[model samples]
Target: MSTSTRAGSAAPSIALNFDSIAAARAIVPRLAAISERSEQLRRLDDEAASLLRGSGLARVITPRAFAGLEMSPSAHIRACAEVAHGCAAASWVLMVCVAHDYVIGRFPEACQKEVYEGDADNLIAGALAPQGTLERTPEGWRLNGRWQFGSGCDHSPWLLMGARVANPEAGGYLTYHVVVRQSDMEIDDTWRTLGMRGTGSKDLVARNVLVPDHRAVPTYPTFIGQSPHATAPTYRLPVFAGLPCMLSGSVLGMAEAGLEAFIGHTKSRRDVTGASKSANANMQQRVAESSAEIAAARRLLESACDRFDVAWRR
Candidate 1:
């Protein structure tokens, strides 16, 4: 019955236009109409993408310094789920892109500026599995190797991925907070799947791509939620607490959609035996159980987000 998350970006102006979640909900009909087209394209349809980008949802977690709303976790869940109720792929992209803003907030301010100031309609995709390698460079770092699950890379101009740095001086380590331009990498169209096909979460391959010193930082601090924007409560929450809470929106949305669809279809259904499932006690019991499970999941997710918000406010 409740949620409070918001953030909107009107570049060059620092005003926070709240109600991105409301905007997302308002577009459900339009989004649902184009869901099939997006699914078939194996990526977001142009209209679908535009709706999300224009609705101010993508800027929800962006720092207010960057003209972003820095939306709340509960609102993030509701917004993503609302979009997913229409199209899972679009919701997936929205959550991933906006959550990156939160990640970038922890990055050095220069990196944040390069991203936010560089593009008013910027969207980012990422894979934080540490599958790639980063070599130290005089100017910055050279990225190599391939990373998996580059979701939304097809639609985004930049990517944040994980990489390994072979530091003989300080032993080996992994970095999940590296940023690279989309111009420097290849999307290996290998995202074949049974569901959520619109995600286009393919593999990303880079060869000696440049990642400027300012663009990349020690992942430890970012993961721990250390940020130059000391005044922003949203950026102060650890990535574990913040990003996952937001990203989970897409997953919960899909599950919610599944539950709704199941109930709808079951309400006017018949089995292979031509018996009415609508009148079947077994079917009724199943619906009740599934509804409870889905409801519980939603509660658990929102409760966690609320806890994070309360704790981080101090």
Candidate 2:
């Protein structure tokens, strides 16, 4: 698909592709096992994260020119859901990491070149919440602040931090996506949660770090597709259009897991009336209804994704 040229115009030429679906499927069992372990560890272990990297999971959304999959958005969503069914934390980390590539691609070519030059598989971990401060410096900008909820931070070599740039005229905040080497930020192990514990999302602290001007991308300009990389068709796609889908895909996967567990339970469980759960007509109806509901919901989700995919590919 050709990249779009018009400013603020999204390129609707990318098509959905699933050549990597089998590869993704092969890793599901392993991912599920590691997911349980990650929950116990309260973070994804290096070994498991490595497995994902090795499995080509991290490259799903990478541009084809960068030796990454450059897959269609639909395929990306499906892959995320599959992994999520096995482990939501693992899937969440993978989704964010992959999505970062797409976001970074919307930057200037120089920035993209610097990021994907050697290893396209390089992992990026961080958040979009504007939590840091950028002060102008001679060389570039001095960044200082603390960003929380950096998922998969333990394995990333580069971190993308969101911070507010002081706008004197507007008397407001302008968000910036600042690229920092992993060494520049200190990782604080503060991820303790009842759910999604395996994510090991922690806080990242940056203190008086100098970031070159080219390393920072403004968020306000990009919302309307007026980014430095807007000339590239890949950069024209709406940022919010695909993110929620990625998150929802993981939720759908978890729901599928719950449904499966319920099905298994129903087969063996007996109700208070001492009747076999599976043999009870009402229980059978409930299970059937639940199955239908899940199927319908999944179909609706996929259909919406397909519609977006078609538009994106046009």
Candidate 3:
């Protein structure tokens, strides 16, 4: 299908679905198994990545036309939270993957087709920070430089890189999104961290990789909703409006995981003050407070997502 028509026809609905929750549950154990390995290796294991792909968890934010679930932002948030309950790094990777799909949807239809049409389930990894240089080339442009914090690189088949095209006439830099196949670039294993180690977020280097004009998107234009893609109602929605909610969902999930651990510890813990931990007023109060905090955070996230849906409808 043509990219424009496919984008228009595949505009995502704002409603949440049961499948998203089910996917979250099914992937939680897989995340747990790989959590330790990710920490030890400072990256996600191949097994965990495959499991996530098999679970269709990565498709939550993918456009429906691309065989994605087209889940509402709220659903995406909830799912990430559930995954974070098992492993923060896994949840973070899932959040980034889903967000990257959303960003790709906002690109020119040609770009979308080039990245997703052949293998709708292909994993894409890279940092969004604009740190590379773009020099004009005959076909499109040659991208050069390095980007760090590329999460899920070990499992991704493609990388989405951000670079600046120097507009001498305009006397400024124009940020652009460039797609490079995995083979064209190098992945550096430098993901040392105190937490969220399984993310495998390292650095990506692109040296004079040629990208076609159809595949390069100007970042600023997208911010104002001037994407090359046709304006479907979904496309008309603000660029990156759903991203923060997705990130917050992962944080909320990790918090929930901490709460669970606290509960487990308290159940059998003895207070240092001689009182039974569960019987102590302070411990009871802490448990109540944590539960309330988690509940409040969930409500806030859902409310924000609800607002995003309402905005999209307009």
How big is the positional error of residue 296 in model 2, measured in Å on the Cα after superposition?
A: 3.5
Ordered by TM-score, highest first, the candidates read: 1, 3, 2
lDDT of 2 at 163: 84
- Per candidate, the number of residue pairs that clash is 1, 1, 0
lDDT of 2: 0.73
Model 3 CA deviation exceeding 4 Å by range? 1-18, 168-173
Against the true structure, candidate 3 has what lDDT? 0.75
State each model's CA lDDT, in order: 0.74, 0.73, 0.75
lDDT measured at residue 14 in model 1 versus the true structure, 0 to 100: 32
Sort by lDDT, best first: what order? 3, 1, 2
- The Cα error of candidate 3 at residue 233, in Å, is 3.6
The positional error of residue 277 in candidate 1, measured at the CA in angstroms, is 0.6
Task: List, residue by residue over 162-281, the lDDT tens digit for candidate 3.
Answer: 887765243144688877787889988777889778898999998889888776777766655567563544445555677778889999989889989888888788867776788888
Residue 93 accuracy (lDDT) in model 3: 85
In model 2, the runs with Cα more than 4 Å from the true position are 1-18, 168-173, 272-274, 280-290
For candidate 2, lDDT tens digit of each residue in 114-213? 7776677777888878898877767877888988889888888888788887552332336778888888889988988898888889999999989887
